[model samples]
Target: MQAEYGGDLTQITDLDLLAFDFNPALRMRKFIGESKSGSGKSAPKALDRMIWQRGLRAFVGAEAAELTINSKVTEQNRKFGRELGVSVQTLSDLSRREEALLMAEVEESGSHGAAAFALVEWVRKYTKSEPELEVIFRFLRSKVWFLDSFTAVKQTISVIETLSKQWVVGHEDDHKKAVRWLLAEAVSVFSLMLVDICSEARLRPRFEFDAFVAARLADGVVPSSEMKQLSKSIDKFIAGLLVAAKATPAVRTGAMGAFDPVPPAYADSFAELAWRLSRWVRASDLPRQIDFLAHERIGLNRPVPTMAAQRIQLSNLNFQHSVSLVCAFLRGHAALSPDASETLLNLAVQPEETMSDAVPSDADVASPPPLALKRPGSGADEFRGQDYLDFNDPD
Candidate 1:
């Protein structure tokens, strides 16, 4: 009855507290009753086993449905009917115990989707000796949202890059200013969207300035000193670009009076190949990818399909490459900052600690393996010492 009432649920820290919290027997009865009434379309038993073994929160509903259809004594899924009686309780218990805690933290943060992602990883790693799951979840969630925001900004930059190419190539001076203005606005949106995404997670305590610093630092793209200096320049550059974009039509028209040649559109037939490279290479190799693109230009009068192909090729770069490419473009055509260049350069040589996917725990390794860096094209073969690309400053 208490479970059906749907009152505000309190945290249950111990199994003892669960007794007073909800009637599991009644809940199980209702769940079983509902299972009997369903059409009983069951999932593969093996797939259900794999999902449960993985303990992924996103697939919890599917696992629950797997339990439901499996409960009915149907020919396709009778394999699970006997076990279903126990498995249903186990599934419900897993949800009831962790769901409230996870959801509460995510709700408080206001970035549920990203938080959900972090919580999954956190739950996978969290233990009694580890930091509180909530703290870990929130911390990782901030980092995850920063990554997501970075991706969004880069996607917008791809569009801006595409349109800018079109603007520069157009012989019509009448629309050149408008195109340049629109390009600038797109850059502003890139910056703003980054802020908006982080703010939604309450990660933007200092407007975008703090979050930007945090993201760059977390990504190990730049040292604290360089980021501090670079952040100021970046703020100014974004504001200046926005101002340039918002300039009066008369001023914009006057600015574009000089003959400015547009870069020729590149063909996208190579897009698929670029995608393959992006997937294979690490973030540090993104600049080289841009260099690869610089040589891939096609004639302005290339067929529509050819232009579309090139656009896809450019878009296929990894998220880091996309971000770096945008920064490279800005350095060439807009604000040229040593700080920006330094920061972008640093992205390729991030400290090992910062770049590592998992902190090596005593529980993780019986005999700790030597630290090594994997070469771009190498598969499962890592070597001692640094593996620096020609473009990356190993130091």
Candidate 2:
């Protein structure tokens, strides 16, 4: 049993120390040492490491983090350590623990805390082998983490819309699967990053999820318009193809039916949809989303119910679509809005409703099942429609 990320000095935290306490009159206590670690002989950098560890503890969802250095920390650094909940120690502490009695205590608790992250690592791992998809893979790994959820999702949609032009028509199932798999993984990655960022922001009195997200997405500057023409071109390019269909093609042909019949919550354009999603996220509801995703991952252990995808005709998928299916659940329930939900559909221009009966009917999907069952003791019977919040309803 190795410590999680224990040997990697490059990581922000240390999970190796295995802490313990002794008490004769009561049960002995043992603590697993977990924290992000960075090295610096200079006091200021050490403080920065402490701060980074604080976020890592929350991101990894660890009970505690410890930062140990070769030299003692400054008096001021010690002060912040106490406030930040990091345990700071020097090299000499190991000298006090060369005896067998201490080893017995350490063994009693066995604080290797892999449970915190073992769940996520187990559910899914994507293998990107297609030469065309290399650009998509690189963007996900390199760019998505640094972005806000909205922009991250938007960029995801945009990139696929661009790459998908080369896809053969018969591969619509493959396309939808790929699109869904990417979005599902994106949500998981983005949510985990959100946990790290949100945990750090909690230290400030004025922190807001929206503002923090907006600032980060902007990266201290205005957002870009470089992709606007690209998005417009693809949407227009496909709209023309839908009209030129001389004979009925497969349900998946022409403009991708994957994104078509824009959900009632969408604003008909990418920019409008972005604004709608920006307004829907709030801190209080954010945890519910996290818990929602966690339980969602938990549910993947079982096989999906029959006819689950309904008219969309999605087959009972494996680990790849698990997180994304949960996200689509949230979108249907109005947790993640429709505009953002399109991200799960791979962000292509949807075909016109008249063009395809293969996709879910506009009215049929107008009400997907709610995100959850009614609570333990509540008799609330309100219908949670796709039009629940009434964002883009044409009144």
Candidate 3:
């Protein structure tokens, strides 16, 4: 991998050795800081700050990975690595043991050691407290466990090697802004890539890719024009997926068989609905909304009793309009097909007076059902409309 850039493998520096030795641990810390926080007894404010920092790491990692995989980026990386004296070695030249050690070392060091250092420096400088920085680092170090494979790690390192040079020489003010924008853009592109991959693989998306997008939109971090662009992009992605699904018989032949055309979690319906809803819902209220809905569903009569019981139960929820509005927004946004939207809307917006037993007995709403779909990533649960699309609901 190193020799691909035309550099002598033996001409390594102490700085390189130090980076290789220490960077992965630093990245592991940052990774935990940005991941979904637990309901642990730690201070919420500090944890919140760490989450964004972790996100920044992911952003950089994704960008580095993308560039490394691109042909143009590959050329640029090789050229730059050659100019910067980055060591390169052909796998054919190394003994099997040497290759194994090289792979192991890269795995240990992580893919973006320099980038992690740069980011940590930014945080350290921003926070202005050495002890506090240590605390954050220690906390993160304790938490991150899931690192990508060796090949993936190498790609991330290549990106770091290429981008770090520009960051090193550019004016501080300009580069800081560039880095900020680059991170955001990279994250957006990464999300698109994930959606495409999920569509192609016919695998249900198990992560909420739009959590940050929802947070940004809610916080007004994104400009109005940009929001419109985002909306358009989302529509286009859904449309393309639909077209692809239609054209490919293999795509329609789900994991089960050709007869089971629709993918799991109502792929063409609720998956898209939840994804788009995640992009639009108020981040703060989403969890509460989800909790309330899940409570209502869990409290409903077993086997739903009858159509009348279901409608009455649905109408009794105080935030029926909010639920209805969510369904309406999804329908208007084209996230739901006409038939699914109509069915969900009917359940959401039905009048309480129309049902024979609009009020459930006092015992009904208080009891939990035999089963509940409360887990966040269960594609089936989110589609039932009982849970608000959490989709990585914000900090």
Candidate 4:
């Protein structure tokens, strides 16, 4: 199967391509061509020529190879550039200002963009420190700090205002209150994680979570029973958060003035909440009842508690179900997942056409509705009732 962008199996093909053609001497020197790597031969030569045509070079260790002159490199470079935005040539030839702009643009494109931008920045800063590069680096570093601080302040004030309003209204069950809290938590957690992840800015072409997850699981000493418990807790927490988010008004309008729509901070809040919730779940003991419930929902034909009862085997079915549930919840709040967070950050840095397209109209904005739990199995009856209530009442 072709490797997806973020999948674990995805090789750093870009790096291999870079080394093979851009620095053939180095490739020959380092690997000695003894290894049966697929990229060691005619492919890199062709890619090199293609990249040379586009006026970009693959920058390899203290030297750069022009793409326009290298057919093999050029073809490969163009293909990668089409999806990633800028070609290898464009990245290498970019002026400090242009480089910054391109970085911002890539960051806006998607999570891949964010990763690429970080890699480029790291390379430009560490590989060779020209005066212009230093200036750009300093500016970027400062901008990142400013952006983070600004987001923190905005989030803090918003949370304070939300709490004050809840206090004044004295409506504890208000759906908006729950939504606001969820949003706040998500933002806080996301911000912290973003900072943590970006701190280790390396030129990694692919994002692999397997190693990270494996290390974390090992650190926690997670067992099969514990994993099941963690999954259940995460499911409940996510469900609650989603319920709250759905209830919160999307827009609020009053006689005096109209409140601005809730920002994407709600999504950020969700991501952050998930991260923290994961920690607690990881630590909790497995709940036998919840595991059984999950097994039934997912359809596992594993044996029930057998043997002397001192050791009841919790099947992998429960763990898998829990994972599926968490993934489903994350998908529902796709805009708030870690992947989405990266995309949002990129967008903030470099506004894209899609982001512009999603901009809402004045009338389209409204606060989320109250959290009305639908009775299970009611189906169309519940839908009709909600529709009637929605038409009959306006808040």
lDDT (Cα, tens digit) per residue for candidate 2, span 269-335: 2222222322222322332233323222221211112222221222212111322433544453324
The candidate 2 region of ten consecutive residues with least summed lDDT is 104-113
Residue lDDT tens for model 1, 1-395: 11334558663311110000112111110111122222335533433542342342122211222232233233433345334432332334445766865543323111124543353344435422334333323332232223344444444445454545544443545234333323433443343343233222222223343334334323333444555566666656655665768977565445441322211122121121222222222323333333222212111111112222233333332433344444555555433243423332232222334333588687655744323222123232222123212212334
lDDT scores of the candidates, listed in order: 0.33, 0.40, 0.32, 0.31
Say which prediction, candidate 1 or candidate 4, comes out ahead on TM-score. 1
- Candidate 4 residue lDDT tens string, 256-319: 1222122343334333333322322211222232322222211111222221011222233322
Please identify model 1 stretches exceeding 4 Å from their true place.
1-43, 46-146, 163-395
lDDT of 3 by residue, 57-111 (tens): 3533321110011111234444543443332222232336456655433221111
Best model per lDDT: 2
| Residue 365 local lDDT, model 3 | 58
Candidate 3: C-alpha lDDT: 0.32
TM-scores vs. true structure, each candidate: 0.19, 0.32, 0.18, 0.17
**Better structure of 2 and 3 per lDDT:** 2
- Candidate 2 C-alpha error for residue 201, in Å: 19
Q: What is the model-wide C-alpha lDDT for candidate 1?
A: 0.33
For residue 167, what is the lDDT in candidate 1? 49
Is 1 or 4 the stronger prediction by lDDT?
Answer: 1
Question: CA RMSD for every model?
Answer: 23.6, 19.2, 26.1, 25.4
- Greater lDDT among 1 and 2 belongs to 2
